[model samples]
Target: MEIQNKSAGRLIKLIISGFCIGLIATIGACKKDNIKKEYPQGSNEQINTWILDSLSRYYYWAAELPKKPGLGQSPVAFFSSVKNASDRFSQLYLPNQAGVSSSRSLYGFDYAVIQEPLSLEVLGLVKCVLKGSPAERYGLKRGSYIRKINGKIFSSSNVVALDQELLTGRTIKLTLTELKDGGYIDQPELNMIAGLTFEQPVLHQVIERGGLKIGYVYIDGFSAGMASTLVSVFSGFKSAGVSELVIDLRYNSGGEVSEAAGLCAMVAPGLTYNTDFIIYKGNKNGGQRKESIGEAATFDKRLDFNALLQNNLSLSRVFILATGATASAAEVVINNLKPFMKVTVIGEKTVGKDEASFLISDQRIPKQVDWEMYPIIYKLFNAQGQGGYAGGISPDLELSEFTLLPLVPFGNANDALLSKALDQISAQKVNAGLRSSINEARSVSQIGRILSDSHLAKATQSIVLTHR
Candidate 1:
């Protein structure tokens, strides 16, 4: 993720700390207009006053709010003042921007760009084309190389502008190209129309190397829809008689908390039904909650676990590929599973956030406030009472993604991250001494910033649960 520089007072601290907290309160309906008629239109200061009241009453750090924040301040400024100084994940966002984080309003084929291997050229790589997305209709496949958009060469300066246009607009033009004979050759341009799409988070495949059949699954996030998909993927692995597993979490920051538990229950071999999986401790005002290990019958969504039983790998150990972006519900998977199985982590250090946040919005005065607040509400601990990993969870073997620029396909044996995991599974040379040369000189693309912004939104709105 590309780091941003901000003023001492206003920091874009992208510290995501949480899992699913089932406190989703509905916001006032969005009208064709942005105006709210329930409350009389007042000066900007009056609006700020309403915001202050909401923060004081419901914010996790209500006690930390200053006694008399100047009401004359803008809502954003007042928000910054009332925020807990120590909390980096607590933040306020505009309602429109917040909508993007929700699965309901979100529609598009999610993709990201990367620097092409052995060159400074940036290429748009399709991360996942949603099942019914326009990208899919237009035949955009994974690993599709997008050389240009709207007749302009994709560069750091124009990527954000193009992204906003593509997401918000009805239609977008693209220019497809390929590198041939060390030169760019144009392919057919496409004009894709945006529509609703349900993303398939579980990507699976099987590999046999060095007399070991490995089941590889790349989970994008732990969305509610993915719970059953995970079961099916694991079932496939079981049917293939795979002896090992590799989970790729490089782009998965987090999603639903229940899904995390479901994944653990599916993979962990000998878990007793209804055992305490993890504990959540909130502030003095916010009581603690415990999540138990059990079948999908206990989940809010009631995910099917029939596949889980049929295809439980029950391996003694599993390999995970992660990066700094691996966090929240993703980290929860790693932390909670440690007691049950051997988890070999290979990649960079984790984001180190072991807390959770709630999606806090205001209806104190009924449509009086037009914003939402995501506040850090609780700290999470595993069954071993281990929490407060604010420095991030360290990897057992540290490797860099920069070693293999423009990442190869998920299960490709040559992919740096996957290769290292396979090596460990096959008991290859302990230290092959392959490291990335990436340093301060690297030029970050604008798409990188766009992705980080989206990721931060997803990471901050986690719901920390307490089970009894």
Candidate 2:
């Protein structure tokens, strides 16, 4: 009996030990799986490589080059002064491209007008005279292959280097391939001088239609000096007696917020406008304070509607042309102007991004890594107390399709959103004219009837001035 009991106990102990081992193995396997999923297989190494490469590029562009111009002070100052790190990096990556889009290459050559890739496909050229040297006439003709600038081959990898070399204003010798009698011929040693200038912001045109004069000003960006430029343009329109003005912000990715606000103030009616809704940060302890961000100096310079309306103008209506590219400061203009004026927003929805960010650098590490974190610093609301237009700004008049097939020119001048805005302004002008004529006639009749009454005449004049 004792031997049988011992055998049973031994069998139970063996079973329990086996179960414990299996459980531990299962747990270990799950932990391994979690670790694998968290970092993937080789993604951590790739991310580290990317970070290093980005830092290296930033150091080269922001640190090394600026020092030579007698402008840049220190590496720390360079990183701290950079407003938009990503944008600066993007410019370095595709030093030549005018703009960056998700579908296109990161960097490419831009004639400072349109963003385009460096390709065998040759487009048209500009015929502008080079500044400061009229005797040295230069023609940048289309279809000319930009073979090697300063004896270095042009490639995507070394495009930034090429850009840096060209920035020196040194004459570059190009080897071109000319199309001759349906055969390609190489032309060696074509000496061409390169001069760099800051990109311009003004796009102006006058469209006369339906016996009405309409003006179009497409502002692609609101950079420094934009406010002065806009003021000048609006003053011109005021002198020209333009019936209507179309402000096209279709591809405006936004810039200086102050400039945008200044532009809005020119047209906004009321003494004060709600540029953005202010938000306060709340803590678990129930403490709260107004959220502050960016360069403290620049924050106050942003648009204040009430201040803008203090200098009211005769401009009654404004046609705002927008698209997905209209964002940040552009959206601020749209939001602030909507309540006070006859704002006709005609385009696709805007890029809904209301919050701001600050750029931070960690110099404690050897890499001197710099990056930006865009926290929802503040929430913005229009006068009507609405926000979140991010999917895009819904067009007042939506078009069914944008692109037309090749060889099928299926669009009219009026079909464009800007053109449509012009039509609306023209119709409004006619209505306004009729109303003005009726008011004038009524005033004349009243004045004539009251001319004999001296006491009433003073009151009538007071009323006229006050109402007007």
Provide the TM-score for each candidate, comma-separated: 0.72, 0.45
RMSD of each: 16.7, 19.8
List clash counts for every candidate, in order: 9, 14
In model 1, where do residues sit more than 4 Å from their true spots?
A: 1-58, 72-77, 91-120, 156-168, 295-311, 359-372, 400-402, 405-407, 428-468
lDDT of 1 at 384: 76
Task: Give residue 398's error in model 1 in angstroms.
Answer: 3.3
For 233-283, candidate 2 gives per-residue lDDT tens digits of 766665566776678776566654456656766665443343432222222
Q: How much is the lDDT of residue 358 in candidate 1?
A: 58
State the lDDT of candidate 1 residue by residue for 28-57, as single tens digits.
Answer: 333324463243445556676667666655
Which 10-residue window in model 2 sums to the lowest lDDT? Answer: 459-468
lDDT of 1 at 153: 74
**TM-score of decoy 2:** 0.45
